[model samples]
Target: MSPPAVPEPFRWTASPCGLVLECRPLEGIAPHLFTTRDAPLSAADLWRRVGRALDAERVATLDQVHGRDVVTIGPGAPPPAGRPKADALVSIDPSVAVAVLAADCVPLLLADRRSGAVAAVHAGWRGTAAGVAISAVEALERRLGVKPRDVTAAIGPSIGACCYEVGHDVRHAFEAARHAAHLLDRWFVSREPGTGIRESKRLHLDLVAANRDQLVFAGVPEAQIHACGLCTAMHLDVLTSYRAEREKAGRIAGAIRCRAYNPA
Candidate 1:
């Protein structure tokens, strides 16, 4: 079956930011999008969404290494480095559209209406364990002078707990992280039961839940966060999953740029 058409065509903006993009014409915040190696489509297919007149050279990508590092790109900001070991990108200039490519990792988008500052982040188990979302929130508050309460955060599709199975290392990482300590038992549950016979166990990591906690911990209000609980692994008809697609899978992109400045 063909993938469902995107809703909203490209308009998925709230007050202040003045802009949004969708995957398809009707898909909210769907354009300004690209396919991953896990999706049904590939980067070559993404070109169609970008338009025939656009140049592929304009698209930027990083070697994302699951770290809390963030880069600023605007005006004279240097071009993106080869898969920089980072998770977040921030900019106040509307010309630049901050993007994050992910198969199951949380596609986090942050925008401040007052300053027109926007951020795109890739937060996965490692990223969440490393506090990448918190880093993005901090960057917005410090660099953009945005009140944490006013920042609108959108936590896009990712691998939900039902599909994410983790190892001890994953659980340990969260335990080692500062604020993550509270969700220890809750984050990691034993798949096996019975006394003295612990055969197997798994970390049912709720990456989105963890990120939401991080946002709130950083002072973002609950109402400001918009989480689209669409699981990539569960929705093959709409999303792409690296775990399911492996190397041959196509990717899905989450992107945003300032639009109030657009005269068109």
Candidate 2:
């Protein structure tokens, strides 16, 4: 599907998608700030929107599969079908706008200001269980020699706990992966607030919390992790959701790009 066209002199919206304002906290970063919604945008509108703000011709995006794959952006890229399979992409190059598309999955943006490196990740329950956030951070450190402390992150909107109902299979997967059988208890919900919720508890999985915990575990500063706490299922009018609307709904893309240093 083609992207929405964004006119020149763009306006940033908190949107139901829950974007962030980090580079210039008071005014926001780059050319635009957003997470995707079911909102229809033409190709010209979309590219024109991102390019004018980023001074580039297009936004780079990935085909997400809810895994821990990390792809570093370099020269000589292929089209969407031919690009390497990965849930995340990082780059020091400004020309590549790290982007990911999702519906009810978490979209994450990270930046190491000191190194001028940026990344965008697609995290779902499967990816979270697979430790994709840590994978992305580790990739940054291993591939580019960046410190977690220097990395600031924005956890964009997704299916929140209030609406992210999950099954025992999902919980068990994460618990088994982390080897912290206790973490399952910390993240689940039940009929009664204090009751043991192992088998009987119907849980609302907090995707943001899961990713935030990973960032913390990876040594990202507590102050630097910003979470947009909106639930895609709850706000169907603005954002898209596979859980709420199923295949009837379309997908929204999350994007971030490197911009030239401005002396403002």
Candidate 3:
């Protein structure tokens, strides 16, 4: 069966810094948005602006090691000595916003409706193969008794299969990571040559598909997960693509803050 069509496209909204992309499902639950390339501010200033827009005291960021490490922040949680070396950050504190930065990689924002918990996840190829998204869902469950089914997720722009071509090394790495065979087939497809182009043998891996499937596997309802389906390489005017831009590429951020505490 073909993959589900992206339910909705992310829209550009005037934000505190400049224009940013907001996901409707996540926006209804809490303060959240995905940064775009329209803004000319430095990376540090952009992050600060995002935090201010969300009404958060400060934004908690991760070191993003491209692995499955997940860190949780909440009451009594000690301050991180420096940036924590994790790919995902889960927050149950309403005053703190968690953010993840990406260029061609996927930046995912998740929110738990019933508990007001939130998470920001960064999943590059290695991180997706390692199941960082799933780790974040589990972190929410383990830390605040939030169920994955109650979580709503928004997958931000990234390198789509249309522009992302990889060699056998990436395929072999996923297999080595022990992903199921069927999923490997669905996420990785052989590229077809186009008009005036030679038949390229490289495989195209769908990072969004891989991460979305992992979220479902972790128990998030399929309908609650929204993907913008924008290809960073295809829309450089509004997005950033590390693969397409190389050393000059700027980062895109997905930021979300936890909901205010209300004693049950």
Candidate 4:
């Protein structure tokens, strides 16, 4: 079957810093965004921008080790003394926003519609192979008592398969991780001619597809998942792309905060 139609739940809006992609499905339910290259110069600056856009006071982020580990921020959870080394963050506090920074890797934002919990994940090729997306979903279920079916996810722009050619080691890594063979076949595509070394024939891995499938496998309804379908490499004017810009690329951020609950 064809993949779900391109998600229409996101809207790009101009901000003081630049443009930010907001997930419409989570509007009013949460404050979230997929930041663009024009975000800010530093993390502090970015948080300030996010605060202005979302009216949030405090934001939490990770060191992003490109692993499957997920950290949870409960209500009133204290800020970490330093950034934690993890790839994903989830929170139940409306006062605290969770964010993940990325250039080429997928930046995924999720919200629990029922409990008002939220998550931000950075899923690169390695993290995707390690099931980072599924880990975040399970973290919400186990830590926040969120039901996967009630969660909505927004996949931000990343290095699309059109430009993300990888070596065979990437495919081997997924295979060694014991991911379903058939699904692996679908996620990794053979590189186009003249793309990579002619003799070796590199592969292009779909980080978005892998993470989306993982969310589905973790119980999120496919229809509820929205993908921006914008490739950072192809749209560098609007997004950052590590692969295209190499070390010069600035990182984009994806952030989400739980909706404040006013007890009647």
Q: Best-fitting candidate, measured by lDDT?
A: 3
The CA-based lDDT of model 3 is what? 0.85
* Global lDDT scores for all candidate models: 0.63, 0.68, 0.85, 0.84
Cα error, residue 264 of model 2, in Å, equals 23
lDDT of 1: 0.63
TM-score of the candidate numbered 1?
0.76
User: Comparing candidate 2 with candidate 4, which one achieves the higher lDDT?
Assistant: 4
Instruction: Please estimate how well model 2 matches the true structure, expressed as its whole-model Cα lDDT.
Output: 0.68
lDDT per residue, candidate 2, 1-264, as tens digits?
A: 333222222233443234322223312443335545533333336545544445555666666777898988643433343556789987666665667767788888887767666788899899989989999999988877888887788776678788778888888788778735555566666645675675575776777877888898888997888765657787666667888998776565667775642211
Q: Write the per-residue lDDT of candidate 4 for residues 1-264, one digit (tens) a residue.
A: 222233567787776456888878877578888888678546557788786777678778899898999988865566575799999998877777888989899999998887788899999999999999999999988876788998899999899988999988888899898999889878987766556332547788888899999999999999989899988888877787888988889888898887863221
Give the candidate order by descending lDDT: 3, 4, 2, 1
Evaluate residue 167 in candidate 2 and report its C-alpha lDDT on the 0 to 100 scale. 82
Query: Which segments of model 2 are wrong by more than 4 Å?
Result: 1-32, 38-48, 75-81, 191-194, 260-264
Question: Per-candidate RMSD vs. true structure?
Answer: 6.2, 6.1, 4.7, 4.6
**TM-scores of all candidate predictions against the true structure:** 0.76, 0.81, 0.92, 0.91
Off by over 4 Å in 4: 1-7, 41-44, 192-200, 261-264
Clashes of 4: 0
- Model 2 / residue 95 / CA error / Å: 1.3
Query: Which of candidates 3 and 4 reaches a greater TM-score?
Result: 3
